[model samples]
Target: MNHDNLLAPYAARSAASRGRKHEEPYKDSRPVFERDRDRIIHCAAFRRLEYKTQVFVNHEGDYYRTRLTHSLEVAQIGRGIARRLHLNEDLVEALALAHDLGHTPFGHTGEVVLNRLMADHGGFEHNRQSLRIVELLEERYPGFDGLNLAWETREGIIKHSSQYDHPGHPEDDDFEPHQRPTLEAQIIDLADEIAYNNHDIDDGLKAGYITLDELAALEIWQDMSALVSRKYPHLRGERQAYQTISHLIGHLIDDLVQTTTENLKAYHIDNLEAVRSHPDYLVRLSGETARKNKQLKAFLYRQLYRHYKVERMRIKAERFVTLLFTSYKENPTLLPRKLQQRFDEHGKERVICDYIAGMTDRSALDEYKRLYEPYERV
Candidate 1:
């Protein structure tokens, strides 16, 4: 039942100083996990979030939900859920904050295009890319390439997907599926859903892409506005919208926490440590709530995600990625020597594709323009 064992590795640094040396600063301060949260907050990738999309392109407006705002919202919601469930607030906040550090520009468009380009080279998954960003891309330390984050944080980053349901041993090829996430990671998944579900609506409305009436007409949405009013009677307009969502998220978190705690008790599961570490572990929902969630998911799919305008943009992104990937592979001279070295080692088009997947949206666009529309740039 002790919590220390679950958290000790994160508290200790991976490397120990050999020097006769420097004393640790600040006699007693926040734990290393807390420090990790702060580190992610200040990283360049975190800052670029402002320019990245979250359901809509950043160019759409100054007020829409960019990646930074979404991350903040997720962190806030995750922390709220964690505190209510008696989980570690810092761990949840850290995981929430770092969850999307590896997202490419232009949202999922960039992700899909990159994945297709790199499909042969182990393919590119955003979750894996996030891991690569923290572990290998960020060059802060001398001895190691990545931030050398704690095992718990790294595991959460890699395996936070809801599909995790495998054994929890190291030797497994897919350690993520087998490994159970800490309670923090569980909060993050729910928090991410809470954030995007509501925020995307906000963005769509602002962009003239959808309207309140249209949202209200959906069968699942009926009376929800009135429910929102009852839950947040004092707020108005956007504030009301935000509070209404916060209320729904709160209800879900309460239900989840209570159900999970009761389930553990009923089963006489004495693994308090395990239960506490994985507050967000997957659990079957009531058919009613499950159906409601699916309905909302469907509404999003039909109305927001599959609109013709979005499809056209996504198609353009696909073409841009494909064209550039093809050009770079045929004439490796166009790419930086560093990337070309990887191409040489792998000696496959897929290896070259992996190189392209790592580029930022702006970087990809620049490469595309450089190759396709040389005079247009002028």
Candidate 2:
């Protein structure tokens, strides 16, 4: 079914997409953005997300959210917001799923080390790496290097920003860096935040890094917990925490949708052009919600992210990433023959960066053992 009739005037319709970098004849009934979402889901990089870090390392536990689960949650939340706003759900889902395609192992720690190592080699950022993965890395298409996704989808992947992601790259000039992306793209940014913020609380609780008593100090958590308690007085322990988080997510999503809708009308944004020409982002949470969200993030930064145990893991990951990059740079032959062959085309540092960036946490650890541990098998 054509989704055009259901979309708002400002929503990005697949028909009006800037189209793919390498055009191919339409071979299916799926919409352009739907096809982009499918291609992203099936790609090798998407599969690797299962082993990539989110807040916790992949092997830490079976319950914590990995990059793959985070991406899925982001997509689910994005689609919900898109549906409520009459935006293109397919495009939003595509953007949400593809947003983290470039993240390295060990969460941001791996990325930090790689950027420091490649300080003179254009540096490494997950957002830019995400764009690179879709535009150049994946080799499934016989006709193109990357997935050959829609221009809007590509723009969303590169422009995706959150507390963790800062998307500014010299190579993204072609995506109209000055203009705002579609509302669908913008939704993924906040959806990502909403997913991670709430889910991180869950993971942190599960990991014993945080406690309900500690979380109750935050106004957002206090309010949500009170509401959940009133609704389910007998609820306690993990179930109570889960209910509180569920209520918190719903509150956030409602506030975001209401605030963004008001912003659209206040700014006289009735069409895609107005969305693009608008000086500031149209998608946002209300002032109060934004402040509460900030408080929660600050709490997490201090309590969970900067916890002693997490810091220990970060330090070890930094050493692993740094040593891997240094060893590979010092010995070009250490890279697989296929990766080494690309060195002449993409430069030694960048090829090594790509190889390291594509690694899963488990793989990186295994590779470290192989390289550094004498008894470990090659």
Candidate 3:
């Protein structure tokens, strides 16, 4: 089927893509963005996400979401929204799946520490790191140093924004920092918020860091909880919590689609060019929904993210990242021979930052023990 034919006029079409950095002959029937998605899925960075942190460390519990599962959820939500809006599902899915490819081992804490450590050396941010991963880090292709993803996919990865992400960087000058990314990329941003906001609630409740009574105080949660109760009176316990979260996610998606459709009309965005030329995001939730979502986020920030236990982990993660980066900086020989070879080309700090940033939570911990522990095996 010609999937492009079904996409809205404003959606990003693979045929119109700016193309990859290192050109290759078309070797398959898959569209350009689809090929980018497949490449991301097979990359080492994506595989490492399986062991990377979301809100909890990998070993915290078997039930909590990891970066891999979070990315999957974001992709699922992004594709659903794209389908409803008649946008390019492939492009949205690509952006969603590859959004967090550059996250450090211990979630935001790791990123924070790394940024602090590299404050003099251009600083560190996941969005830029993600861009680097696709453009120059992952060495899968014999012809290129990185994945050589489609320009749209690379733009989405760099421009991906959320409360946690600050996307602009000096190295991203090639991506037109002044312009808005495609609507597909914009969709990934919100889809990412929806995934983490809702899933974090589930993880927080499961971990006993936040309770239902506290959540009931938030208007968004109360509204969803009431709806879930009315719809499924027999639901109780964790099942009820799950149902409420499910309903909340559905409500958010529905509101986003409706509001974004209204925005497209309001802003006169009828084509891909219009989307990019627009002054602000064409994809967004309604004002009321945004306010409610903000409230929910604030609640999570105070109740879940700031919980004593999570803070303790954050502190430890900071220490681990700081120590690791410092050790690698002081003793460049400690890095694997492969990483050491890149020191001449990429500089020592950046090469070390890249190596440490790519670590999974467990691997970072294991590496720390091997380097510092007297009896631990290297």
At residue 44, candidate 3 shows an lDDT of 97
RMSD of each: 5.5, 0.9, 0.9
Give the Å shift of residue 170 in candidate 2: 1.6
**Model 2 lDDT tens row, 202-310:** 9999999999899999999999999999999999999999999999999999999999999999888899999999998999999999999999999999999999989
The residue-by-residue lDDT of candidate 3 on 157-228, one tens digit each, is 899989988866787899899999999999998999999999999999999999999999889999999999
| Candidate 2 runs further than 4 Å off | none
Give per-residue CA lDDT, model 1, range 1-378, as digits (tens).
Answer: 434444322222213212111133434555656766876887767777777777766655688887889999989888776666556677788888888887777778777777766766666667776777777667665566666666667767876563212223332243345445555676677678767877787777767777777777664455456777786677677676556555556655666667655655565545434443544454334456557766766777788888887777778777877787788777878877776666555665755554555555566777788787858662
Q: How far is 273's C-alpha from truth in model 1 (Å)?
A: 5.6
Comparing 1 and 2 by TM-score, which wins?
2
C-alpha local distance difference test of each model: 0.65, 0.93, 0.92
Error of 3 at 370 (Å): 0.3
TM-score (C-alpha) between model 1 and the true structure: 0.80
Clashes counted in candidate 2 amount to: 0
TM-score of each: 0.80, 0.99, 0.98
